[model samples]
Target: MMLGSSNAAVDHPTSNVTAFIRRANSIMRQLSSATLHKFVVKFPLLRGDADHLDRWVSLSAASRARRIVLDLCPEVEKFGDKNQMYSFPLHLFTGGSCVGGNPCVKSLYLGFVSLNLLPLAAGGSTTTSGFTNLKQLTLHKVSIVGDLQSLLPECAVLEWLSLTYCSLHCHDLIIRQPLEQLRYLRVLQCRLQKLQLQAPNLTEFEFTNQQVPLVLGDCINMSMASVELLLLSDDFDYICTKLPVALPHVRDRLTVGTAIRTEALVLTKAGAVFANLRHLILNVTIHGCPQASTGVLRLAYLLDLAPVLEELELHMYCVSAPGFPRNPRDLDAMATSPPARLHERLRIVHMTGFHGSRGQLELAHRILWSTAALDRLIMIIGPRIKVDYYFRNLTFADTGRLVARRYIQDQFPGTVITVL
Candidate 1:
């Protein structure tokens, strides 16, 4: 039987109102920690100057929790300022009763809470002593302040770590462990200055930090990387110069996804080269409706950096809706795309962003004339409302193929054309 309450609103929550909720712990504390395999608690509308979440974590630790999820913030924090977030208890690390501390807690998740690693006593560094067996840890919207070193050191065998919208206002967040078994690491929408990731066995690393310089020490074994917010514009040359010095081996598969207003010209000047990069995908989003007379010309220039790139995909997007999204009835369908050669090793090319503007039409044809040995040319077309409503009323796909076949006939006419 499920034994937690989802009290929508605690009118007064006075001593008498919360007596039953507080007393429910007596039944829980009576059971050994080994008996509880999983525990979940969701408190709703904890009102005015009252928070009992700390006691819940203590009880979970003492009860030998294996998987624990505590969500203290389910609604907008408009009540008393003191009741916004719960402070996690730190005494669970120090073992007094049992020599084996929180040994069963392998999966731990805390949402809208505070994990202050600083010692509560007069003077002591917070220690992750009992968290030796922690394997999977996720902290979302968690304010991790003070000494954070204690919570990460004892996690020697941690495999996966994800921090989303977490505020770590410390000097620099470091991850260093000899032969650290960490394989996957992702950090998104974080406010940090410097990040140092030194995991030897790391395979997949995805980071989206706001212009934060990443100093990688032991990421020599990375295979797949999804990076954003690093090479934002041509003005910032830090990522270009620092990437090789930090991680000598660039991942074979690279995906550069960005929504900011950027031109392909700016990305080429970054002074970075992918000597071993195999496949590259560019997902760029423009700020406003692109002019019909001109194409962005941002993606074609990147081909020069990856000499051996075999497969390339371009997923273009526009911020605003285009006024006229169809080709004219009398418009000429056949025209020279352009100078004829951009990539020698390129075999396949796929484009998804199309509004049938003259600029995009010209760019599409240019790719056909340039690649001498290209195998496939795919252009995906859709209406502008695809952005506003998102997949509810998008039915302009057939137009994508019509534009590709009639106009921009490649110099190598054998290249297969696919429109979706």
Candidate 2:
């Protein structure tokens, strides 16, 4: 069951929240004791509509709804305080009055609501009655009050948990107990100072926010992890040394994204290795000529860490600014030591924003020379028009294509070269 006005419906001439609520109430009355497998409610709710909101929640709960999505967010996200937003009645479901004493709510998505877990009794002291059967829960723009740690244990069987845009005020989220069933976890835009969780069965994890200390204790089953944060050149050392320890057991893939910086970049620790990692993706932005070559060359250190990696992808953004070199070729210099042919297991290498610059060429040559098992080299020849305002050689796209077809094809006879 789905009821509510979307952003597009809000602009329609016939859209009326009052009439819509009345119609929804009438339809809900017809549902009576019918079980609801999925229930979705979306509308711009105001303080005056408290009764209607309560009735909706009560009806959904009573109907044994398995999946519920409440998106009664204001059109403009300018709620003055938590009191002005709807306070979700979590106690009713926890007390077992709702859903005929069987809390069947398996998946819940709450938006623009306030969640206060204090009223649900101390965590695991009373009972894991509320949210015990919940496998997935996502909160968007929800004001979360009280300790989230207390609430997690109640959802013992949770497999997927996501928190986005929730106001937590730099809360240190620590999960003392293990979540054995959890397989996926994602947190975005929540002001968090630190995250330390132990989800033994977790296979996928993603976090996007300010730099914070992350500790995922022994995620033995973890296969994919993504960490995107605001980073400066000084943070390079921290990323190299700390990230491996944070998500220690990532086996299949890892992706890291950082802000555009021109300072000298390097991986200080080369001892740590992602022995089981097959694919590695890097997204970075480089300032023109002066630092571009040195900055990008330093990425070889990453390849050195992922020795058995089969696929490599680089999303390089080259930005043009004042003091940019007039000739990119002048900035290119050979590494002090000759390039080593170490990546015997590497097979595929794909690159985007290939400007045919000196730095790009060096990296490409290094990969081709090292990866004896390479089967395909795909390079997307282009520039970010918005960022690359004044390239020294605007015809770098043509240059990139020419080099890929001739140089790479001639050097690596068996490998397929694709230039776009």
Q: Pick the candidate with the highest lDDT.
A: 2
lDDT of 2 by residue, 1-420 (tens): 999776534454235776788888998889877888999998767556779888888888888889999986776545435567788887667737453566788999998888876633544453335777889999988888876776787778999999987887438777777888999999988888898888989999988877788987788888998887754433455556677777767878898876444446544774556767788887765653433565566666666777778788877666643133456444333342345546667777777766655566667777776665555544333333222224443445665565555555555566676666
Per-residue alpha-carbon lDDT of candidate 1 for residues 1-420, written as tens digits (9 for 90 to 100)? 124555545455455336645655665556534456677765532433234455556667766667787655554456424335666675564454233433667877777777777533333333446677778788877778874555766677888788877778675667443428778777877677777866778877777766667766657677777666634343223334455344445567776665544233344254556666677776665553444333255445556567677777766665544324354643465465556456676677767666554555656666656665655544343333322225532343345445555554333466666555
Q: Judging by TM-score against the true structure, name the best candidate.
A: 2
Mind sharing the TM-score for model 2?
0.84
Global lDDT of each candidate: 0.59, 0.71
Which 10-residue window of candidate 1 scores lowest in summed lDDT?
A: 380-389
What ranges in model 1 sit over 4 Å off? 1-27, 30-34, 44-52, 75-83, 95-103, 119-128, 176-179, 228-253, 260-268, 292-295, 320-347, 362-372, 376-402, 409-412
Clashing pairs in 2: none
Task: Return the TM-score for each candidate structure.
Answer: 0.75, 0.84
